[model samples]
Target: MKLTLKIWRQNGPEEKGEMVDYQVSDISEDMSFLEMIDVLNEGIIDGSIDDKGNYGPVAFDHDCREGICGMCSMYINGEAHGPGRGVTTCQLHMREFNDGETIYIEPWRSKAFPIVKDLVTDRSSFDRIMQAGGYVSVNTSGNTQDGNAIPIPKENADWAFDAATCIGCGACVASCKNSSAMLFVSAKVTQLSLLPQGDVERNRRVKNMVKQMDEEGFGNCTNTGACEVECPKGISLKNIARMNQEYLKASFTTE
Candidate 1:
């Protein structure tokens, strides 16, 4: 199959960027989206078409392409992770698009996620937020009870697991017009709120993480629900509601 790709090109963080067109042919329908991009880059690196020797390879992020890394975070055709629900760009297949189609690919757009290059954005802000307090300081170094030994309700366990599926792709932030990171933050908060292991430092974790999220310059969630719609994990807006409740409760309670 032959396709047209309109991809964003940027030299560096300080440089201006724009969409540049390229053509790819003989693409296999079974190939993952990133594989198709690799084919495109191979052509560029091989000097297949020398437009004054300036047509270079596209730079995008992908590691552990099994959809767990969340590094393949490009916006495609106006949707985060491209035309799919509950799947990252690496999991997206070429067959999702028709033959001879035109695709627009752009990086995650947010104040917190400044573009490092073409399709790569700096997501270390997320790391800082987690560091602020996304952990349970419990001591499990010695012989510990088996996970099943503590009998949590099935509903609570399931919800916690659901919230844990978040890959921190920032799709939720890119899809929001306000570029809010609330869904990602809320997922982290809710996963801990549901489990007993995470109960010890619950108040401090929520307070510090939320404070760090705001400090990172991420916008507020305005109930647009776009974050939930675009999240590759389908992390629910209910997590955000739960986070708000957690924050308010943390306000009145003293540790």
Candidate 2:
């Protein structure tokens, strides 16, 4: 099968980027999109064509191509990752594509996640948000309570675990039109709100994280489920709603 990759190319952050086309022939339909790009890079390295040295290697991001890490992010074929409801590009298989297809690839385009190079964007904004007290501040004194001692309801425990599954991949920012991290922010908020260990600093966590999220230039959540739908973890938008309740309560209560 043959595929035409229309990929975004930019020399630097300040430079303008445009879509550049390349034809990939003999591509197996079974090969993942990243795998196909790898093959293209190998061909370029092998000097398969004259003046190949003039052509730059295709750039993208991917560490655990197994979908566990949300680091492998890209706008594939106009979708967040690809033609999937809740999946990352790494987990996205090539089987969903067809022969002689023209695939468009772009990085996570967001103000908070500016493009560093090709498909790689800087997501330290997320790190900073987490740093703004997304954790509990307490002595890890070896004298701790037993795991089963806390009688948390099954439903709450399940929700807490689900929220903890967020991989911090920044796909929520990528898919959002406002480039908001509300879903990601909300997930973190809910994860702590539902857990016993996460209390003590619950009020502080929501305030700090929300403040940092706003400072990062993320937009407000307007009930659009794009963030949750594009999230590879299938993070529920319900978490955002829960966050809204928390934020409202936190806003009125004095520390």
- Model 2 lDDT per residue over 129-209, tens place: 999978866566987777589899999999988998999988888888888898999889888878788876777788889
lDDT of 1 by residue, 87-193 (tens): 99999999899999999999999989999999999999999999998877766888766768898999988889999999999999999999899999999988987
Instruction: For residue 34, give model 1's deviation from the true position in Å.
Output: 0.5
Candidate 1 residue spans exceeding 4 A from truth = 50-55, 141-144
- Give the C-alpha lDDT of model 1: 0.90
Mark the regions of model 2 whose C-alpha exceeds 4 Å error after superposition: 49-55
Clashing pairs in 1: none
- In order, the Cα lDDT scores of the candidates are 0.90, 0.83
